[model samples]
Structure formats: C-alpha cells, structure tokens
Target: MDSHVFQAVAAAAAALLLFLTYHSLAFVAGKKLPKGTRLPPGPPGKPFVGNLFDIPPEHSWLKFKQWSDLYGPLFRLNIAGRENYVVSSEKIANDLLRERGNLYSSREQLPAAAELLGDNLRPLFLPYGSLWRRTRKLMHQLTMPSAATTYQPTQVLESTRLLDDLIRAPQDYQKWFARYSSSVIFRLGFGKTMQDEDVLRRIMDVNHSLERVASPGSYLVDTFPSLMHLPDALAPFKRELKQLHEAELGLFRELLDDVKKQMDQNVAPHCWERTFIEQQESYDLTTDQGAYVIGTLFEAGSGTTTAALQSFVLAMVHHPEWMSKIQQEVDEVVGTSRLPEFEDMPSLPTVRAVIKETMRWRPVTAGGLPHQLVKDDVYNGFFLPAGTNIHPNQWAIHREPSLYPDPEVFNPDRWLDPSFPTFKEPLTVHPNIQNYSCFGFGRRICPGQNIAERSLNILVARIAWACDISKAKDEHGNYVDVPLYDYVSGFNTHPKPFQFYLKARSPHHAIIVRSALEKETQSDPLAGK
Candidate 1:
C-alpha cells in the first residue's frame, strides 16, 4: 500500500480505539426495575455520564439540598451511570435507614476508601456482613452508654487542658479543640495520651486524604472501578493512594505496637485497644483488623469532636444571648468554686440545649456516610434498586422549616419548648432520631455517640461556665466580622479557622482553670484509678 493509504488506516484505527475506550470508561451495571416502577424525581442528565458534572466536588450537601428543594425530599442522581438516592426528610430517613435498616445498611466498596486507604479493614467502610457486625459488636462493647461513664474522667481531664489552652492562647482555639479531641481518642485507641501536635497533624492528614478519596466523584476510578485494573505505571491516583495507605498503616501499627508493649509490661490502661486485643479471638478479629478498628474510631471521633467544639465557639460568638443564658444556667448550677461535672448535666438544661443546638445548627457531618441497599425496595411507589447509595442529608433534614422554626438561627430554646418536636433527652436519643441525626442512622449509626456526646457536653458546659466567647475586636474597637457559615468541606465539616475572643469570665474562673490543668498535669486522671 502507498504511504498515504497506510497513514489514513492508522489514523482511523486510533479513532476507533478512542471511541471504545471512552464508552468503556463510563460503563455501569444497568438496573432493570419491575414493570411500571419508577425512580424518584431528580434533575435531568445526559447519556453515559448522567449527572457526572452535576455533582460538585466540594460542599455537595448544599447542591443536594437544592435538588431536594426542587425535587421533593427523595431524589435520585445517576452519576457516571451510577445510582445515588438521597433522603432529605427525617421521616423518610427514619423509615428506611431505621425501620428497614437490614435492607439499607450495606456500604459501597469504593476503591480508595475500602481497598487502598484502609485495606478493607476499617469498619466504617465495611459492608453489612460478618466483619462489620463483629467490628460493631466490639465497638458497642467499648462505647455503649453504660461504658461511656468509664471514659468521663479522661474526657474531663482533657477538657480541663482545653480550657487552659483557650485561656492561654485564645486565637488558636481550633488547635486546642483538635488537641483535646485527639488526646481523648488517642487514649481510647492506644492507652496513651497524644503528647504532641505532630500526631494530630498526621491524623488530620489521613482524614483529609480519606475524605477526598471516599467522597463521591472525587476520583474517576471510584466511579468506574474498572480503571483500578490499570497497571501502576498507568494509574497515578493509585500510586498516591498507595503512599497514603502505607502512611496510615504505619501510624496505626506504631500506635498498636506501643499498646502491645504496654500490655506486655502490664502497664496498659483500660482502653479500647487493650480491651479489643484481649477479646480479639472471641470477635475473630485479625491483628490488622483490630488495629484498623481502633484507628478508624479515632478518625471518626477526633475530627467530629473538634468540629463540634469549633462550631460551638462560632455559635456563641454569633449568638451571645444564648451563651449568656447557658452561662447563667451554669453559674447557678455549678458556681465558680468547681467546674461543671457530668452529674450537673440534668440541672443544666440550657447547657444541654446549647450542645444540641450546636449540632443541629452546624452539623459536622452534613451528609452522613452513605448506606447501600441490600435488596431492591419500593417506597411510596418509587423503585429503589439494590446497591443504590443512600445519603441521609443532615443539612437538609436539620433545617426542615416544619420541624425547626427559623432553622438557620442559633437558638437553643427550641429544645426547651413543649410545642417544639425536639427529643426529650437529646443525649440519650437513638442516633436515628432528628436530635441525634448528626451522628447518623441505622445499623451504621456511630457506635461512639455516647462518648462523643459526653465529651461535647462536658467541654461545652465547662466553657460556658468559665469563659466568655465573643467576636474579636479590631484596633478601632469594632467587632471583627465572622461569617456564620464559613466551614471547610469534607465528609466531616468544621468551621474554617476563624478569629474569636475567648476570655475567662473572671479572674477567679481563670485561677480555677489553671489550677485544674496544673493538677491534671501532675497526675494522670485518665488512668481511671
């Protein structure tokens, strides 16, 4: 053949190959529904890449909320041909994630989340099966409400340090919150307190990586898992994920090794790690499984607790009236002679209300972790296929105008109002309820809710009792502007670090805060002796 003919043939072959590759990249298993069945209403999409570009990479809950507003509470999105069903109402979420939990409790196996970052060992990403059940059982054994009291001394001790940190360097309040939250989780996971900021940074780094990888539409490979079959030389994302996996494994293993050493010396404090290890055989958990279980708990516990504390500060700075009311309630119940304790919780209804309001106002997990369906189901005449991703969007659910009047405002009075449909005891409510929706729902509801609430309650109560959280002032003595809705985007959202003025309420309060810290430093209160 002539040179011109050969070139034309080669070019045509390349064009055909490209077409096939593009078509293959968007392939997804088609769901065949029963006759006359229909999916929930959602925005229209194009062929092969349905709603692919429609899904935003960051702050998707906002987009989801907008869709819910337009398409009713239940809606469907077909992204890259994958089906995602979002639930925006408390009633629908409760009916599915709670009432029919067994059919909706499984998790999707995202490549970055389950295979690379966590080696399929993290319980949070585990599917609804024996492994998930075992891990959850182990978690319940350590974090049930009955088990929560055992960790109060640790929480109180760490919270005292948080109060001191606020008094010393109010501007770095975010770091103080992170430190306190991580310290508690570290002690719980490893039987040792986090001594340096480096560990917390490392933990945050892992969390950030996971958030990006696990989030829907973050990576093409996650959507079209066939891409994972590509060789390492061709897949750059996998290489990066491999590095993250190694780093996370190293950190978790080092922590576990330290706990094992302590256990060998019989000096290990009673903690989740020690307890899990001793009972591992009964749970049929491998060493790696045990380590990842504890590590994922730290991941789930620390970032959320830190985010909640940061939001609490924002709420107080934005709505000082509620803060004052809480402070007055705290003063009357506990006084300045001693910091507020767990036993004072019932008498300090305002403090409890503040905690509940903070969670509702600025949920850390705006869109709760996605739950996959185990079987095809119909709800109110709409067909939901098995393996659909279900997102119980807390942002939309919490802000439902019917349930919460003026939902955007930071008001705690709703909880106290008899006419309001608030959970009677927010702290004791099941995770599926409206008040506890921040934690999540169904079989996958956060097992650590009890301890997390305990931590938030103690810290919020103490901060209310001892400090005045207000907006910072400029050189001209004008209040510095703080946006009420400035938050970092992730699976676990947090107030983007902002300036706030946190001062001890009085010199006596300052002295008390310092004294408690000094005493805690001199002795290990977390030893639970």
Candidate 2:
C-alpha cells in the first residue's frame, strides 16, 4: 500500500474512534443522572426528537388525557432530547404543586417567553425567586382582603354599566362582558371609567396579540428552540416575533408612561399604578418592575374576569332555572328595593353556589400554565427529571369522575350542602369538595383571588337579580344552542361570541333600573329637574 493511503486511513480511524468515545461518555453521563427511573412507562418515541412530532401542537390537553389514561397519573414524555412529566391526577398535582411547591415553582425554559417579555412581566411567569417575591408583595398589599373593600364602590359602578349595556343590547353581551371587565381593571389600575372610550377594543387588541403569541404552536421556533439560534436570513420567525415583541412593549410602555406622568404630577388617581408608584422607593421597584406589576394586574383582571362573566352568562342562558333560583335568593336577602351588595354575598348561598358551578363547568384557563422543574424530584416512587416541563391539566383534574361525579353537568347543588365547604377552605374541612383549581394552587396561585371573587360574585348576583336570562333565537325563531365546549383557543379559554335573550325579571326590576339611572341624572349638574 502507498504511504499516503495508509496515512489517510489512520486519520479516518482516529476520527471514528473519537466519535465513539464521545458517544460513550454522553451515554454514561445520561445514565448517571436521573431524568426518570428506567423501565417507567412512556409512549414509544423516535430517537433524538423523542415524541416531538407525535403530539399535536394545539389541544395538547387532549393528548395529556390520552397519555395519562394509558400511563397512569405520573408518566414520562420526551421532547427533543429532553424529558417531561405530564401530571394528570389531582393527588399528584397537589403533592407537587402544593405539598412540595418550593422545588416545583420555577418555569420551563421558554425562549419566546424569555425573549419577548423578559423578566419584566407578571409574577406568574417570573422564576421562583426575589422578582416574584417583590411583585407579589406589591400586588398582595393592594389586592388583599382589606384593600379589596376600598375598591368595592368602583366594582359596583362598573358592574352597573355592565347591566346597562346588557339591557340596551343583549346581542353584544360578549363585548359588554369584556368591556365591563376591562373597565373595572381600568378603573382600578388607571382610576378612570371607560365611558364610550373603547376600553374593550383596546383590551381586545392587546389580548388578541397576546393570544396569538401564547399559542404553543403559534411559532414553530418554540417547538424547535435550536432553530432560534439560526441566522435571521434563515429564520424569518425571529423577525416576526421581534416585531410582535416590540409592539407589545410599546403598548405596555405607553400605558406605563401615562401612569408615570400621573405620579410625577402627584395628582394620580386612586389606582394600583398610583399605589405602586407612590411607594416605588420603599418597595424597591424600578420602572420595569412597576410596569410589569401594573401590566400583570391588568392582564389578570381583564381576561379572567371576562371569562368568568362569560361562563356566568352561559350558565344563566343554559340553565335559566339556576338564574331564577339565584334571583329568588337575591330578592329574599337583599330584596328588589336595592341592588345586592358585597356584604350580602355570605348570606346568599345560592348565588355563591352558582359562581362555584360556573367556575367548575368552564374554567378560564382549561389547561393551567406550564410549570418546569428546577431539580430532579421523586414523587410516589416515580422520578421527574430536572428541566422536565410539567402541567397540571386543570380540565382533566376538574373532570375526574372520582373527584366530581357527573362533572359534565352544570349543578350548583354540589356546592350547597350544610357540610359542603368553600374552595377557600382546605380539604380537611370537607374532602368531598376540594378547592376548585379555578384560581390554581400552591405559591403560584393567583394573587387577585380575593378581588376576582368579589368582582365575580357581585356581578353575577346583580345579573341574576335584574335579568331573566334565556337563549336567543335565529331569524326562523329556532332555539339557538351553545356548545358547552365551544371556546376560543388561547392561553385563556373563553366562549366565542354568542347571543342570549335577556329581559328585566319584572316591571319592578325595570322601574328600579330606570330609577337608578334617573338618580344618576339628578346628581349630574347638567341635568334639569
């Protein structure tokens, strides 16, 4: 053989040997570390990609149920080269989400989320650390039980507008609901009422943008994060996302700047932004922090409240009997002479049960936000590896027959026994009705739960008190049915626009509504006697 040929063969052998050596080293390292215990059940997946293509991009929740049923409560799923655990049972969810929450609080590595929002977003997305702690402190101080009382007058005023809108045009109920929710948050966050100023339009625009970006499958770059590193020429999605990122930033910053100016003038209205701005120094808050705090509160209040109201309306239309029942309760307690107040909520068991059933039947966030593990953890003898993306499929858990019998049906009776306990109480009080996962669980549970609960209760009670809700009909006058599961696909699940017929329950109710508006007119200086 020639000397040159021999040399080339030697070099090729050396390269092949190096490749094998590296592969062996990586295999041993993977074995040493615990992603999950070997022999645990998981769907058969392709090598390297690991079930990435097997799962549908949208409606991942359905896939979760299928796998959970096939593999049990705790099962392993591999994405790309990484492993994730799909937690479907309430027991496993509670164990990790609450019992051992500290280790389970960090977020999964989402490149789009990180790049777009940065750390300047809600405490919900913030890693389990100081940033989250600080934001929560500010929100808690403002939205806690006591502070919620101070905001009741605004809630009442805003809710009244909702009723007025419904009375004027019931077909626009969805928009009215959105407007009512946005107006409440605007009033609380910016200290201004949305009187024909298109609050819903502005909120819907931003929310639509957010919804587009939040879809797990919105951008293919998210699925294959390695693609994010590709050059701009090869990766057009980067430019698109960047454009969206800037647009959202501009929107948030514009709003933030107005609040900042209000602070500068020291004439800012009584709002959450003003509260945080005044104590910015004391709370160690930067402009970015304040922006996110305000942004998140607005996001939470607007989306969640709208969905809840939508659910409430949907329930009322579908089951007018419940509406009648609650209206009777409202009349019996607060009477037709006056509007129902927050204080009346405790005594109004039927109304409270209605709210519970609405939350149960159609959760705002069907699939709770994804949570990532920061470290390798073991639960019930199953190992969950570090970096494993976790989701407590709230829809599945809520629908579990074992937990809630006949979960598909909208029944308020389940929440109304003498021994039945509220979600506010732990299961030790009554194991039959575990806290609705509506507000979520663990440290990451919604901070605005108190305010949300109050706002929802008051609005629902008022609707039941004032309106007789029933299904709307087509031109042919056939009864229009609303599919219970039909909802807009987004980070938050809300029913699509649908019409409902509503009328004052009685002439007395109509008279009272007219009288309330006339009273407002009497108070206005422009109105003549």
Candidate 3:
C-alpha cells in the first residue's frame, strides 16, 4: 500500500477512537443510575445526533404533546446528548415542579439564552441561589397581590386609553394593545408612561430577539455547549450573539440612567426602578444587576400582557356568545354611565371567567420555561439524572379533555359551572389556579402574575363593556373569517396580526370613552382620570 494512503487510514482510525471514547464516557457520566433504574419511554432517535432534527424551531409544544399521547404522560427526548424530560400529566407536573420543587426549580444553562441574550443576569433565568433569591424577593415585594393594588390607577388609565384607541383607529387594535401593555409596565417599573415611539420599538425588538434566542431549538450552541469556545471567525453565531448581548445591555443601561436623571431632578414618579435604585444596597445588587432587574420586569410584563390582551380580543371575535354574556354582565354591574374599574371585578364573575378561559384556551407560553434538576432524582420507578430539562407542558395540560370538556372551544362557562371538575374563580389567586397552568409553577412561577392579572382584568372588562368586537368586513361587505388558531410561535405565543371590527357598543359608551380621554388629557395625565 502507498505510504500516503496508510497515513490517512491511521488518522481516520484515531479520530473514530476518540469520538467513541468521548461519547462512552459522557453516557456513563450522565447515567449514574442504580441497576434497576431506567429512563421514561420516548420516541427513538438516531445515534450521536439524538433528537436534534426531531425538535422543530417553532410550535414545539404541539409535537411534545403528540409524543406525550403516544409515550404516556412522562417521556424523554435526547437532544444532542442532553436529556429532556417532558411531563404532560398534571399530576406529574405538580409532583415535580411543586411537590419536589427544591430539586427541580433551578434553570438550565443555555449558552444562547443565558449568555448571548443576557438573560443570565435576569432572575427569570437564574439558578436557585442568592442572586435569584434576592431578585425574586424584590420582585415579589413590588408585585405581590396587595402591592398590585397600588398600580390600579395606572391600569385603569391605560385601559381607558385602550378603549379610546379602539374607538378611534380600531384597525390598529393590536398596536394599541401593545402600546397599552408596554405603557403600563413602563409606568409601574419606571414611573413614566411610554411616550417615545423609538423606545417602544427598541424594547419590542429586544423582546423579539430574546424570544428567538431563548427558544429551545433556535440555536445549535444551546444544544452543543462546546461550540461556544470556537473563535469569532469560525463561530459566527457566537459573534452575532455577543452583539445582541451588547445591544440589550445598552438598552437596559439607557433606561436605568434615564431613571437616575429623573431622580436627580426630583421629578421621577414612583416606580420600581426608582425604588430599586434607592435600595440597591439592601438588595445587594450592582448597577448592572439593578438595571437588568427592572428591564426584566418590563420585558416580561409588556410582551406577555400584550399577547394575553390580543388573545382576549381574538376570543371575543371568535366567540361572540361569550362576549355577549360578558358584556351583559359588565352592563349590569357597570352601567353605561362609566367604565369598569378594578373594584367591579369581584361583582362581574363572567368577565373574570372570560379572562381565565382566554389564558387556558391559548396559553402565552405553551411549554413553560424549562426547569433544571439540581441532582439526580427518581419518580414512579424511573430515574432522571441531574441536569435533566423538565418541561411542564402547559399546552397539553390545559387541554386535557377530562379537565376541560371540548378543550378546543372557547368556553368561559366551565369556570361558572359547579359540576365542572376543575372549576375555580380566576381572580382569587396570584400565581396560578387549581384548574389552570398559565403562570407556571413552584419557585420560578412568574413573580409579576398579580399585576399581570390586574392589568388583564381591567383591560378586558373595559373593552367588553365599551366596545363591540366582531369579524371585519371586506370591501364586498362580506365577513372575513378570522383564523382562531393563527398565532406567532415563539417563547411567547401571540395572536398574529389580524383584522377585527371594533366599535363602541352605543353612542353613550362612545361619549363616555371620549369624555374619559378628554378629562385625563386635561387633568393630571398620570392620574389617568
């Protein structure tokens, strides 16, 4: 044989040996299980690659649900040698994320999400430790159920603006919703209403980028952490991610600095940012940490609230019967003399039910953020190793037929029916309900849920009370069919841009909306009178 051919064969053999040895060691290290233990059942996958190709970039929760049906409530997927345990059963989800939360509350380290998107600094993605604990404590203090009441005037004002926006340019209802949602968060977190269009655009752009990066399968570096070490020239993904991180950090810093400027002038309104800056030492947070803490609040509060309000609008357009019922309740409780207020929420159970149904009908985060196990654990005779990704599949859990009959239908009646198996009042709690799984579970449950629920309740109630939401009509005077399930897929699923016909229910309601706007514009704009 030629010397060159022999050399090439020898190099190939050496490379193969190295590959095998690395994988063998990795497998043994990950699976430090007792002899009788085994992983839960899952679909088969190819060697080396595992289920990398099987995981789609968008709407992955649907696929996970399908697998759960076939593989039973608990299943596993090996994505690029990473073990992902998906729990579709409510019982299993409760058992792991709630019952044994100490073991499963930490967040997994995603190179793209944590490092590139700068989410590692945010408590939402932080592991269960000092930083996370402090951040969460601060967030809880600001957004706890009682604390949420302090923001009622802002919510009421923004919701009234939402009503006026719908009455004026109903075609841009989605943008109006986005504006209202962002404005509320801005007021709460920064003590200022969102006035600069450019600032709003930048914040939304950052959120869109964050969503893509944080998604499970969008970045290969998340699956193959080793790739993070490659040089910029060879690993363009890393360079791009670094740029994204800088951009996000710059934005957060800019917002924080603006708040400081206001404080220096003694002109700043009461906001979370101002409070954070004042008590930074108490929270043991650096300047950067303080900025990201407030930034995370805006990021989480704005996008999710916007998506939820959009969902409520979509539900109204599709299910007019429920809309009419809710409207009737609002009219009976809050007459045309004025709009609905936060206090009216208790008397209007139907409106509250609609809010709950909207969340369940189409959850914003279909597959809740992945939780990481701090140590190897076993449940139901199955061994789940440390570092396993736990997915509490809210999409599947919310749609269980036994829990919600005709789960596909937008039925608010389920909450009102005493005979229904999982009926509960929507506004009775802060984080989640016994029947719903929208806010997530356990230690990492959304800390801003109380404020979010209040924001939704006021906006949804006011919208139902003041406007008539219906299908848009085409030039030919024919009703256009609004696709019920049309939504933009990402870490946060939102209704895609769609047309709807929104108009004041009566001239009296129109007058009330216009009067409220005029009064607010004339008096203290911040008061939202």
Candidate 4:
C-alpha cells in the first residue's frame, strides 16, 4: 500500500476506538439509573466525571450552597467518581435522616481513614450493625444524662483553668480554649489533670492532627478510593497518614497505659477508661474491644466538645453585646462570689440561648458526616438510589430566612418565643435541646451529647459570670475587625484562630478566678481525704 493509504487507515482505526469508548460509557450510564427516574438537579459536567473538578479548593460548603440554590434543595454532585447528595432543607433532611434513618445511618467508607488511620474501630465510621450498636450503647452509658452529672467536677475544674488563662493572657484565647477542651477530657477519660507540664499541648496536637486528616478535604486518597489499594511508597498520602496514625496511636496508648497502671496500682482515679477496663468482663468486652470502645469514646467525645466550646468562645468574642447580656443574666441567677454550676443550666434562659445561637451561628459539623443509604428510597416522589451519600447541609438550613429571620445577626431571642411550644410544635424538633441535630440526627446521633452540653453549659455560664469577653482592637483603639466567616474549612467548621480580649468582669471576679487556680485544693479529687 502507498504511505497515504496507510495514514488514512490509521485515522479510521482511531475514530472507531473513540466511538467504542463513548458507546461503552453510554451503556454503563443507562444501567446505572432506572428508566424514567430523574436524578436530582446538579451542576452539568462531563460524562462519568460529573462536577468533581468544580468544587473549590477551599470553602467547599459555600460552593455547595450556591449549587444547591441553582439546583434544588436536594442536589447531587459526583466527587472523584463517587455520588453525593447534599440535602439543603430541614424537611427533606428530616424525611431522609429521621424518617428513614435506619437505612441511612451508615457512613461512607473513607478508605484512608478506615484502613490507614481508623483500624476500622472509630465509632463515627463504624458500619450500622451489631458492632456499631454495641459501641454506641457503651458511649451512651458513659455520656448520657445520668452519666453527665458524674463528670461535672471535671468540667468545673477545667473551665476554672480556662477562665484564669483567659484573664492572664487574653491574646492566646484559641490556644487556651483548645487547652481547656484537652484538659476537660483528660480528667474525664484518664483521671489526670492536664495541668501536668505539656499535657494539654500534646493532646491538642494529636487532636488537631486527627481533625485535619479526618476532614473531607484532607486527602486525595479519600476522594479517589481506588488509590487506597496502591502500596504505601507510591501513594504520598499513605506516608503522611502513617505518621499521623503513629502519633495518634502513641498518644492514645500512652493515656490507656497510664490508666491501666493507675488501675493496677489501685491509684486510679474514677475515669471512663478505668471504669470500663475494670468491668470489661461484666460487659463481655475483649481487651481489644475495650480499648477501641474507650478510644472511640475519647475521640468522638473530645473533638466535638472541644470544637463546640471553641465556637462558643469565637461567637462571644465577635458578639460582645450578646456576651454582656448573657453575663447580666448569669449575674442575676448565680452572682459574683459563686461560679455557675450545672444545676443552673435550666434556670438561666439567656445562657441556654447563647448556647443555641452559637450552634446556630456556626455549627461544629455544618455539613454533618455523610450518611450512606442502604436501600433505594423515595421522598415526596423523588427517587434516592442506594449507595448515594447524604449530607444534611446545616449551614443552609440554619441560615434559611423563613426558618430563622435575619439569620446573619447573632440574636438568641428567636429561640425564646414564649408561644413557641416544645416538642408539641410540629415545626420544632428537640425543643428541650435533648436531641438537637447539634448532637446529630436519628439513631446515629452523637452519644456523648449530654456530657457535652453539661460541660458547655457550666463553662459558658461560669465564664460569662467571671469574665468579660470582647474583641481585640487595633493600636488606633478602633474595634479590631474580625471575619465572622473566618472559619477553618473542614468537616467540622470550628472557628479559625482569632484574637480576643477576656478580662475578669470585676475585682471580685478577678479574685475568684485567681483563687480558683491557686486554691486548686478545693477542686482536688481527694478533697474529703
């Protein structure tokens, strides 16, 4: 054949190959969806790789909201070949997350997390099965309402340290808040005070690292799960995950070993780990089971509680007038000499509103951990296919103008409507805050919510009573502008670092703060002894 004939033949062969590939993809797409079933509206994109590249490098939540508006309340996005449905309305979220909760409780498998970091042991990622049930029950026993009262002293002591730290070095509010969270959990989980040198720092470091890796945007390996099967050397994230895994494991083991040693020596203070380990046989828990159960409790309870408290501080600093109002309420209820206690929680309406507003303003997990559907379901005639991941967009729901008027402004009054009935009102769910989505929704809601709320309530009340929190200003004495939206982009949207001012409300409050630190003996676990 001539050279021109050979070139023509090669061009024809290339065209045929492209046609085959397109036809194959078309066949797959056809089989993927049922006939006459319309997928939720979403950003238009290329075949088999829909809208994956459209997601922003940062503030993905903001991007998601814009897409949800352009599309409908229920919108779909394919990220790295996996399908995700962002539920933007409270009603839709309720139908899927609450009404059909059993089928929608399992988390999407994060391969990097499951294999590399989690050991498939973390409660948050546990499949919705017997294993998850057992683990959750254990957490509930330890953190539910009855159990929360037992943990009150730990909350008080830690918040005392927080108030003192804020008064002493207001500039380091972020670090102090992190430290407070670390210390609070340390006492509850390990029966050790974080006042031990560098203890809070070490714990905070581990938690911060875990937070970074656990978030949705942490690693490409999570987005493209096929990469998980690749060897450690070839995958860059594998090496990074290994380091994080080691750091996390080391810290967890050290705390566990300390608790074990204390138990062995009969010097163990009453802590979650010590209590559980002591009764492991009665609970039918294997040593590994006990370790993981306790570990999950430590991880889930600590990170979320810390994030909430940090958000509260950030909110108060940004909205000083609200802080003042809450402080006034605290003064009327509890007064200056005595710090507010857990018992005051129900009585202090303003304190409760502040807590609710903080959660509303910036929920810790704005786009909650995605729940994977186990079965095909239809809501209001909209088909929800199995294997689709669902995330309730709390940011959009809370900011809905119809649900919360003037949503941007920090106003707690919205919650205090006298005629606003409790659970009796169809519009309101969890009116007593017992089952607020802040903890989460349905059967898979956070088990540690009671303990967390008790801790938050006591801390916020006492902090407001003893200290005056305000924003730091520029050298010109002008109010320092704080980016209210300056949030660390992550699965859990905690406030990013910001400067703030916290001073004792009065000389009497200053005395209380100083005395609380120095006279730690009053808070000494062995006070009676």
RMSD of each: 4.1, 6.8, 4.2, 6.0
Worst 10 residues of 4 by lDDT: 421-430
Better of 1 and 2 by lDDT: 1
What is the C-alpha lDDT profile of model 3 across 1-529, one tens digit per residue?
Answer: 5788767765765565447545844783465676788879998877776777997778889999999989988999887677888988778888999899899999888888887778478667888888988888788888887888988888877788888888989888778988998998988887777788888888998889988888777886777676665546556788888888888899889988888998999888888988898898899988888888888888899999999988888998888888899899899988879888887877877888888889998999998888999988989889998888899998998888888899888888788877787665443432133234788888888888888888888888888888888898999999998887888878899988888888889998999988987776666455531
Could you tell me the TM-score of candidate 4? 0.88
Model 2, range 152-252, lDDT digits (tens) per residue? Answer: 77677667767776877887887788787787787787766666454446556666766667667676555556555555755566777677666656666
TM-scores for the candidates: 0.92, 0.86, 0.93, 0.88
Off by over 4 Å in 3: 1-32, 425-436, 525-529
Candidate order by lDDT, decreasing, is 1, 3, 4, 2
The clash number for model 2 is 0
- TM accuracy, model 3: 0.93
**Candidate 1: residue pairs that collide:** none
lDDT of 1: 0.83
Q: Which stretches of candidate 2 lie over 4 Å from their true place?
A: 1-29, 33-40, 117-122, 196-200, 418-435, 517-529
Report lDDT per candidate: 0.83, 0.72, 0.83, 0.73
Task: Between candidates 2 and 3, name the one with more favorable TM-score.
Answer: 3
Task: Indicate whether candidate 3 or candidate 4 has the larger lDDT.
Answer: 3
User: Candidate 4, 3: how far from true, in Å?
Assistant: 35
Which order, best to worst by TM-score? 3, 1, 4, 2
Query: Residue-wise lDDT of candidate 1 within 1-529, one digit each (tens)?
Result: 5788767765765565445445643543345667787779999987666787897888889999999999999999886656798999999998999899999999989997889778898899999999899888888898888888888888989999899888889988877888888888888777777775677778889878877777766777777776676657556888888899999998888878877898899887778888887888999989888888888888888888889888888888899999889899889989879999999886877787888888999998998788999898999988998778999999999999998999888778788766677646443332122228888887888988888888988998999988988899999999999998888877888888888888889999999988987887778844432
